[model samples]
Structure formats: structure tokens, C-alpha cells
Target chain A: MLNSYSSADKVLLAVDCIIFGFDHEGLKILLIKRDFEPEKGKWSLMGGFLRKDEVLDSAAIRILDNYTGLQDIYMEQLYTYSEINRDPVERTISVAYYALINIENHNAELTQNYHAQWFSVAQAPKLIFDHDSMVEHAIRRLRYRTSIKPVGFELLPEKFTMRQLLELYEAILSKELDKRNFISKINSLDILVKLEEKDMMSSRKGSYLYTFDKEKYDAKLLNDFVLNL
Target chain B: MLNSYSSADKVLLAVDCIIFGFDHEGLKILLIKRDFEPEKGKWSLMGGFLRKDEVLDSAAIRILDNYTGLQDIYMEQLYTYSEINRDPVERTISVAYYALINIENHNAELTQNYHAQWFSVAQAPKLIFDHDSMVEHAIRRLRYRTSIKPVGFELLPEKFTMRQLLELYEAILSKELDKRNFISKINSLDILVKLEEKDMMSSRKGSYLYTFDKEKYDAKLLNDFVLNL
Candidate 1:
């Protein structure tokens, strides 16, 4: 039966990662300067060809680990770019993935070795191929996913201040949300555990810290809870 | 530069479509009996291999047209499945697309010629390969997409009564909805032009007909509106 597919066309398969991070600066994407390619020296998303034995998920994870030296990141398959001329060198269909990683957790040496840097999504430089369009689609998916799931937590530290949480949401949403409304909405979700500890990073009066109640979050996943702004 | 990619392994690419339809019955999916080797005579999705000169979107559209003889249907690329042993015959990565179509509009003769049948999503038969999983994923996506966009209109007629619209939502969500609440929520969207004409199908008094205001729906697409039950 394998012989039946012999006459079918074969094409190169590649996986691209749009690694998003959030911190005091804003939402940022990890990009590497391509050392070898048809478009060498251009900034592009960290990517590689899919190995024969690996599945798409494993391929995406492998690519991310190769550059970030990070594991167990929250990643999703975004979309596939299959324009006949998307790749100038070959007819490669690239499956894109968006990963949410804690900005502070990645290995600095690995990034430095690969000439990788994080740029604020808005200030991202020109990317090779259709990578700019990939980034745009990823941002849209991130926004839509954040509204339905508590995925924004992936970009934040385990213990974070309400101000940090608000900032993270604002960054992902790319908008300024009213503090009171935001706090009230978060409170209504009842999935946050307000800690007695405070973080004195921003003001003389420290803001209270909070952690996501994973148990509650997991339960909420079974229901239709829309985090409307 | 093209020679640089010669070392990379190539794989066969295929596109499978989960064609969804709705009529007076309920939410349904189009399934076809396999007519070739490997999965001969077993139920499968409408699928085909990608041609060297075509893109993924074009491949999907072509496959759908070949099976259904319908063009310009509402389709979305759902996901890519790439397990090592997913295709027993060869190493093939299948990209799944879900299409919404009006059941009454499809070519009846074409469907019969292709051995195609529409089964209620809940009662769909056991399909070959990972097709059952593909159908499950498509339904989940359809539920999510219908909530954010007015895509349910694609499964309905150009002019339909409020009863038909309510039934469509009921079938998609697979749950009963409060009639007054559903109508009020849809009315608030203000993307439906209610016609003075009536359809006497459900009741003798006749129900008012309504058509989707495309201009208004397009504008609504720019905003974040959740049509919650």
C-alpha cells in the first residue's frame, strides 16, 4: 500500500515558533538573526525543518528548546503558511506555533549564543519570509485565546502583584484597561488567591500579590466562562 | 540556496475536510465511503493529496469542490495532524479543514455519485484513521467560532424565520435555549433585517422572515461581540 503514495508530491515541512513574553517592558517576541539561509543575517522566528521521526508538536518543542533552553512552555499550533512561493529557496510549508514563556526563566547564555533577542511586538524588526504575517496572526490568536482561557498567566511569574497582572493583560491586549474595572472583573472570576504578602516594586505602599488558583482554573475550563472586558 | 535544503526529509501532505451542514433536521457532517485501497469501503472525510503547484488553501478548496461540487463555501483551516503512524500506508501529514454549508444548496446528484451521506454530528459513524478525532475537533471549533462570529448564518438560508434561526443555534450548541432570551440577544446585535414577509412552515400564523445584513455583520466582525446563550 505504501507504493500507492509514491507518485504523490513531497514537500519540505518546517516549524516556526513565535515565542511571546511579557514583563515590565511589554509583550515581546523572541527573534533570532538567521546565521545561514537564503535570507542570511535577517531577523526571523526560531525555526527548523521537521525531522522524519518527529511529530509536529515534538518538532515545535525541539525548535523552542534549541534556542531558548526552556522546557514545558505553553505552546499552540497557530497556522500553516503554504504559499507556493512562501519560501524563496524551496516549496516549504511552515507550521507556525506561538509559545508563551516567562521572560525571566529563559537561559541568557543560550539566547546570546544564538544571537537571539526579545523585541516588543510593536517594535519588532522586519522578519524574513512571511514571518511578519505569522507574527500578526499569532498576536490575534493570543488575544482571542486570552479572552477564553487564563493563558495570560503563562507569561507571568507564579507569584505576581495585581499591578503586574494588569500590566500583563494590558500588554497582551495592547490597550489601557481601567484599573477598577479590571480588578473587579478579575475578582468576579474568583480564581485568584490574594496573598497577604506585598510586592514593593512599584510604590512606597506595596501592592498585594496573588496567584492563580489552578484547581479553580481547571474547573472553569469545563464551563463557558467568557472573560469579557 | 535550494540545494541547501536537499538534506531535509520531505513528506507527503494531504488535506481532509470536515464538511458540516444544517437543515430542518439538525447539525450534520458529510462523510464519504472510501473507494480506494488502505481504507477501502470504510467511512472517511472528503480528502485529497496536495498538488505540487497548489497551496494548502487551494488544495482544501479543490478537494471540497471535487467531492461536493459546491464552490464558495465557508471554510476554515482547523488543524494539522502529524502522528508518525497516522497514515499506515506512508508518512503523510494531513491538514484538516472544517467547512460550513447549507444542506439544501449542495448538489444532490454529486453527493450520490460520490457515495456521500450526511449524518447528525452526534450520530456520526466510526470513521477510519484519525477522522473521528478530526470531527470532534471540528465541532469544538465550530462551537467556538459560532459564538464569536455570526457564522451560523452560513448554515442557514438567505431568508429564514426566527424559529429556524433558534433551531440552528439549538442544534449547534446541542442544548435548549430560552426563546425570548435568544431572540433578544440576537436583536441586540442589530445585524439582522427583519422582513415583513412571513414563512408559514412552522405555524399557521406564520413567523416573520429575517436576512443577515452583511454590511452590519462585517462591521460587527471588527468588534468583540459574544453571542452567549
Candidate 2:
């Protein structure tokens, strides 16, 4: 019997983060220019090697925090990419994680320090080392997540207009949704708190703002409801 | 600049499979009594250390085939488990995959050779080295997959009665479903074809047998639809 662990080969494990943000422009992802060899100067997802002592989740959190100086963001383990020669330098398996962050909240100095920038997911540059496929998979997962969860709460400002909320869904789904149906469905969820404050930027009449009810949103997280948009 | 990969720690990567099969008894997961130390005789998911040349998907398939002698099974990358000391003997990160197979189709002799046995998912014994949590996660993913895909077709016989289909869903969801509502929702999916044949063993008035429409199933795979049962 091969009873010992000494004979098994060990390989480097990397964690790459697909940090998603949303603004009036649409959904975007945080990308950094690689400063190391093999894919240096190319656009790529922010990533780092997993130390022996760190767990995968912590590694993902550490990488995301390192790049954006943002904490407590909504992040999930997306997928593990393990194509041979995926990393030109060595045999490395990358576990991809995706995070939803409010765009305006991240520190500008931190992003500038790492040379990270946000690009619209639709028009993002071709990425390095299977990162393109990772982004595509993340978008599909995000779309599925949006139907079941109120992702707009994470991406949109605390006080957002109905149009902003609808646009967030449209961007994630990559399609146009009927305005009437969208608002009705959102109303049915009953987790949004309509605010007295109005955003008067779009028109003189102004539009009422809303915020996600945290207690109700947390309840919905526990008991998932289908928002068939 | 730290540009080389030579200094980073490399950890052993393993792939553990939660092989799910369905019989009249309900959903069962294949588990093996470990023959090698450090947890000899304890139940564990069928698993193996991934070789340097192998991808995770291939490693999962190899492990499943090694135990069940089944090939071309429907498998998916579920998640990666990386608690710092998940494995007793080494620093290892396990990428878990789940497979759906027909219980009657696997080779009994091969399973016997490996001391692998099917246990009702509800009554599965305690497993070693974080495997219990792995099974729990797999079952959750299976339940989610059931809502979006025709998983009964993968776990059931080629032609099945409506009772078998309902039972499969019940086992996966662990809840009794309303028969009329279940059938209506399934009918709306338009993926099942009622056949002229009947399973005479169930009753004097044998229930009608049905087979999934492969073309429609393929289409649904490409364009996902919700099955709110």
C-alpha cells in the first residue's frame, strides 16, 4: 500500500479574484496590469499565491483586500481553473473568487498603488491566462445570483432610484427588462424600503430612493425566494 | 523583485468525489471504508491525489471509475475544501466533484473490491477528514441542480413511472411534493414523453412509463429554465 504522503507531487495553488462593481455606466470588473514575468504588462484579474498556512477563503479575502483595501465585501468562490500549462511558469491551480463591491467606496490610492482599474465587463480588455473564461463564468453566476438574491444592494448606493436598480439588473442579465414587470417583481420581494428622499438629477419631478431592508434581506438569504425576472 | 515561482509553497492537491446514485430506496452516495492509514476502516469519499499531469476533472473521473468501474458519468466541479489541516498526513487542498450515476449500472464487483458501498444520504455514516461536510455541500448543490435541470433522467432508469420521478425529487429535496402540482409543473417543462409501456409491478393498473425527450433536454441545457416545484 502507498501509505505515505511523501510520494505525492505538490503543486502551487493560486487565487484569482474577479471583483465586480457597478455604477451608472453599468457593471465593471477590477483588473490589474501584471508586473511579473510570463504575462507582464497584460491585463489580468488580481491574484496571488496561496501560502501553505492559509486556507482558500482567507487567501481570497487577503488578495481582494490587498488590491482594493476593501473589507467585508460580498465574495464567493467562483471556480477552480486547472488546465495544464494554464500558468506558463509552473504547474499552478487557480481557485477563482468573485466579489461584489460598491464602486465609490474603494480607496483610490490603493487602486492607484496597484495600478488597478475598472473596465466595463462588456468592453474589458482581453485578459491573461484563462482569465477571460473566468470572467464569463463569473458573469453567468452573478446573473443566476441576482434572480435569487438582491445583488443590487451590494452594488448600488444605499439610496438608489428605481431606474438605477433596474439598470443594475439589466446590466447583469445583459438584456432589456420590461420596466413595469421589473418594478412589480421588485415590489413583490418586499425587502426594499422606499425612502422619502428623492433623486432630482434625472428630471424636475424627481424619483423616490430606496434602500434594502437588512433584516428582511438577511431573512431572504436564509430562505431563498425565486425572483423569476 | 520577487519574480520566480520557486520560493512559494506547494501543497498536495486531492480530488474527492461525491458519487450520487438513485434507486427506489432514495438518493445514495458511494463511500468507501478506508484501507490505508491514518484513518483506516473509516468511511470516506472515493478520492485520490491528483497527479502532476492530470486536470481536476480527469482526476475526479479516474477516482470514480476506479471504485465503480463506471465511465462517462455526469460530473461537475462542486467546490474546493481547504481548511489548513483538512488532511492529517499532509497540507492538502481537495477539489470536490459530484457525479450522478444510475445505481444499477455500476459494476458491483469493482465496488466490492474497494469496499465501497452505497449508503442512504440521510443515513450516511460519519466520514473522515472533512468529508462529512463535503457530502453535505454536494447534497445542497444537487438540490439546486434538481430545480434547474432534469436530474431524474440521470439517476433513474431509461423509462420511469411518474411515481419514480416524484420520489427522486422528494429524495433530493427531502420533502413530499403535491402530486398534481408536481406533474403539472413537470408537464409545463415539456421535456418528458409518456410512453405506451407500463411498469406492471407497481399495481394492477400499472402506471405509465415516461422517457425524457433528449432534444428538448439538450435545448434546456443550453437555455436554462426554472422548475419551481
Candidate 3:
């Protein structure tokens, strides 16, 4: 172990977070303007260098918090970007993390200070390095995650309408599902509670709003649940 | 990128390959003996340092070839393990690549020279650093992959039987699938071509062997083929 600990071959490691959020519009990703050189002024995902003592996941969370001022957001390590010259300056291996945070959860001033803005996945500007691919991969992962688990709750507000849930899924999956079948399948799962309060925003006879039952959701996760529609 | 790049912040980046193969018994992973290291004589994943000019994917292939006498195998970048001290020797960030190769198609002796052997994922020895987690994650990825793609062909000989395909999936996924349903699903997907020859080794009534239709597979990949059972 001591011999392998050579100073000759050490390299830099970085953590870049792609924070995803969903609002009435669609799926959006958090981007921060690069305040430092070589890609200074260019838009990039929220990122930071890994510290000497932080785990990759912890470092990712810390970065997400440092800039956005949020906590306990759902984040996943998507992939490692390791092209030789991915960073023009040096060989830095960046582990990309995709996070799901409520858009209203963070401070607006922090976002402005960091020059961070939310952009729809499709509307995002040309990103630095393999970030476009990173975001692409993260979206795929998000779709997969949503299909398997009750992950729609992560992006949406605490309570949401069935239409909102469907829209969120549609945005993540980038496809349309059979409306009746989608509603039926989700209802059959029995993990969503129909809330009495309904916001008559999207329909004349507004659709019944629903919230994910965490107790049931956790139980189903222990077993398994599939949202194929 | 200039401010982001830290040549002084050099760290060790290692490529660990989770070499997967399938045989009569089940799915197996290639392991190697450490001949020169502080942990010499111990079992480890086949790995090496990232070259200055190589991409992570190429580095994975290079490391696998250097130790296994294998090339042109189906290898995918699985995940990066980056707990700061996970590498006992230094701050090493390991990009794990999961390789699916045919067990019967490789040079066992070349791997044997370096004391490399194939072990069932469950029975593999305790690996150094975060390799244990890497193997676990790779297996999870393998399960997810088996459901969506007909990649089991990569682990089998050029020609195989439906029974073998079912067994491979069952073994990799660690679950039982209804033979009838599995066969029907495989047939509907149109990824396998029934061979004129028969394999009499595993059954009293010789099983009709099949080979993967690579052309059809390539075409089918144009649309994401979801295998439902």
C-alpha cells in the first residue's frame, strides 16, 4: 500500500453536479457561469474540486449546497468524465452527479451570485466539455429512476395533480403515454393519496390532485414497483 | 478550465475492469493476482494507471488486454469509485469498466500467467479499495442491461440454445423467468436466429441452437427495445 502511494502518478479529481428540477414548464437543469478561466464566462454545470477527505457523494452534496444553498436534495453519481484533454488545463477526472431538487427550495440571491439559471433540458446552451453528454446521460438515468421508484416526487412540489405527475414523466421520458392507461396503472399501484384540495388550473372540472404516500412508497420500494406506461 | 485544472493537485486515477463471462454454471468475473504491490499475492481486479494520452475507455481495454490477452470485447464504463481514502495507498479515483466477454473464447493461459482467474460474482475474493462496491454496482448494471438488451450473447459462445440464453439471464439477474414467457419474449424481440444445427449436450431431446442476429440487433437498437416478461 505504501509503495503504491507514489507521488509520481497522482492526479486531480473533480465533482460536477447537474441539478434537475421540474416546474409547470418542464424539466430544467441548473447551470452556473464559469467564474474562473479557461472556460471562464461559459455556462457549465455546478462543479467543484473534490476535497482531501470528502467522499464523492458528499463532495457532490457540498457543491450543490455551496452554490444553491439547499440540503438533502436527491442526487446520484451519473458518470465519470475522463477524456485526456477534457479540461484544457490538466488531467482532471470529474465525477458528474445529477440531482433532483425543488426549484423553489433554494435561495434566489445565491443563484444570481453564481450566475446560475435554470434552463429546460432542450434549451440549455452549448455546455463545456462532455457536459452535454453528461446531461443526456443524467436525463436517461432520471427516466429510468422515475420508472422504477416513486422518483416523480423528487422533482415536483410536495403535492401535485395527476396531470402534473404525467407531465413530469412525459418530460423525463420524452414520450407520450396512453392517458387512460397511465392513470389506471398509477392508480393500481395504490401508492398515491388523492388530496381533497384541487387547483382548478388545468381543467374545467379539475383533475384530482395526488401526493405520493411515503409509507407506501417505501414499502413498495422494499418489494418492487414498475411504471411501464 | 485553467483555474479548474490543478497540476499540483495531481491524483492517481486507476481503471478497474469488471470482466464478466457466462458458462454452464453461471456468470463469472475475471480476477487477477497481484504479483507486485504492497498487497502482492492478493486477488484484485485487473487494473492499471491511466496513461497521459489514453481515454478512459481505451485505458480499460488496454488494461484488460495487458492482463487477459483479450481485445474487441464489449466493455462499458460502469461507475467511478471516489471515496478519498478508498484507495489505501493514495487518493485514487478508479473508473470501473464492466466487460462482457465469452468465457470459452479467451486465452485462459494468458490470464493464468498473471494468476488471473474467473470467479462467480458472489464468490470472488475480497478486493482491495472500493472494488467490492464496483463489482456490486456492475452486477446491478448487468441485471438492468439484461432486461433491456440481448447482451447475453456477448457472454455465450457464437451459437447457443434458448435454454442457455434463459440460463444466462437467470444467472446474471439471479432470478427465475418462466421458460415459456422468456422464450416468447426473446422470439418477439427478433434478436436471435434459430440455427439449423442442434446442441444435444444439455437435453434428451436435442435443443435447437441459435445465434444472435447482429444485423437485426443493430437495426433494433435504433429503437430502444424493452423486453417485458
For each candidate in turn, the TM-score is 0.91, 0.90, 0.85
Candidate 2: lDDT over CA atoms? 0.80
The TM-score of candidate 2 is 0.90
Q: Per-residue lDDT tens digits of candidate 2, residues A1-229?
A: 5334788888999999999887667788888888888888999988889988899889888877776676776579999999999998998999999977767767554555566788888889999999999999998888766644567656777898989888877777777778887787778778889999999997899999999998987765322352110
lDDT of residue A63 for candidate 2:
78
Give lDDT: candidate 2, residue A191.
87
Error of 1 at A161 (Å): 2.5
Q: Candidate 3 lDDT, tens digit per residue, B50-100? A: 877777889888888787777787688888877767766677778889877
Query: What's the best-to-worst order under DockQ?
Result: 2, 1, 3
Ranking by TM-score: 1, 2, 3
For each candidate in turn, the interface RMSD (Å) is 5.5, 4.8, 5.8
* Candidate of highest TM-score: 1
In CAPRI terms, where does candidate 1 land? acceptable
Query: Which wins on DockQ, candidate 1 or candidate 2?
Result: 2
Best DockQ goes to which candidate? 2
